[model samples]
Target: MKPKASPKTDQSTVRQRIVDMAARLFHQQGYNQTGINQLIEEAGVAKASLYQHFKTKDDVLQAYLAQVSQDWFRQVERAIAPLDTPKEKVLALFDLLKSFLESVDFRGCNFQNALVELPPAELNTRQLIRGHKTKMSQVITDLLADADPDLAAQISLLFEGALITSQLYHSVEPVNAARRIVERLL
Candidate 1:
């Protein structure tokens, strides 16, 4: 017979499930358009359970972004893991980005979509988006140091442009365009 699990493990599992569901819904639909009922239904959790985990939908949205940020960072690290040089690592970033675009459920960058929907009054949501940008920019800055320090800033901007443009246009060409530009510049 198995030992009884701790309450903490159960709570964390539920919290993670909620985040997963919200991330998917928030990506497929805009943040404002996704209702709590949908999240609860998709997550297969009771309304009270969700409320116990988060006081409001805004809180869940923030958690979803935070989860995405962490998962993205891990993916970045994994993408660059096999590459030995910083330049290879820089190129690897584009490859990793391409993989995301090709994913079956790819919508857009959730953080970008959320930022567009989050108004001035949604300070917490805005801060979460800004934080993700800063972190991703820092990753670019580190990877591009071997190519050119200043180029990191440009590359970071280009990365964002690619993400937003590809998302809006529903074309992988924008990402390819950015990658070509990066290759030519570096």
Candidate 2:
């Protein structure tokens, strides 16, 4: 006999639970360090259910990255919404990064972390990372529409460097320095 299907809401809940647990685990520990069994236990879902929702752990990682991308963009939009002028908004981006670093205890960029942890063979995950970064660069580009086109690229590099440096130092000093450089650039 075939097994009965779960309700739609239950299935959605299970999937979200798994993704949420995976996000936390993958962030707190590197992706490879987290095990499928731990995800099942922490998510409070059956092993079969996890496989039902995600054919592989990589699928779960993809979902986590997607969710993070959406959340990150939303936060950025909200952070810059109240500012006036492109320069102010662009500078505010660094402030937002500083807040984020402190909030996460200087864990650094999730996309960067995933890129470092995931093998190049994981093309889908790498593409997601690239897409998120491209979108972020576009945001800066749009904000600097009146300025030299190349400034956006320079600022993007500075932003990424600051994140990595902040993570290394376990402090927001790098973010502050990046903000100073951005101020000069603007």
Which candidate tops TM-score?
Answer: 2
lDDT of 2 at 21: 96
**Collision count of model 1:** 0
Candidate 1 residue pairs that clash: none
My TM-score estimates for the predictions, one after another, are 0.92, 0.95
- Please give, for residues 106-168, the per-residue lDDT of candidate 2 as tens digits: 888989999999877889999999999999999999999999999999999999999999999
- Evaluated against the true structure, the overall lDDT of model 1 is 0.86
Point out the worst 10-residue segment of candidate 2 by lDDT.
2-11
Per-residue error (Å), model 1, residue 94: 0.9
Cα lDDT tens digits for candidate 1, 1-186: 999889999899999999999988888888888999989999999999999999999999989988889999999999998988776787778878878977824477878888888778989889888999998999988776656678999989888898878878877788889999988887
**In model 2, which regions exceed 4 Å deviation?**
1-6
Give candidate 2's TM-score: 0.95
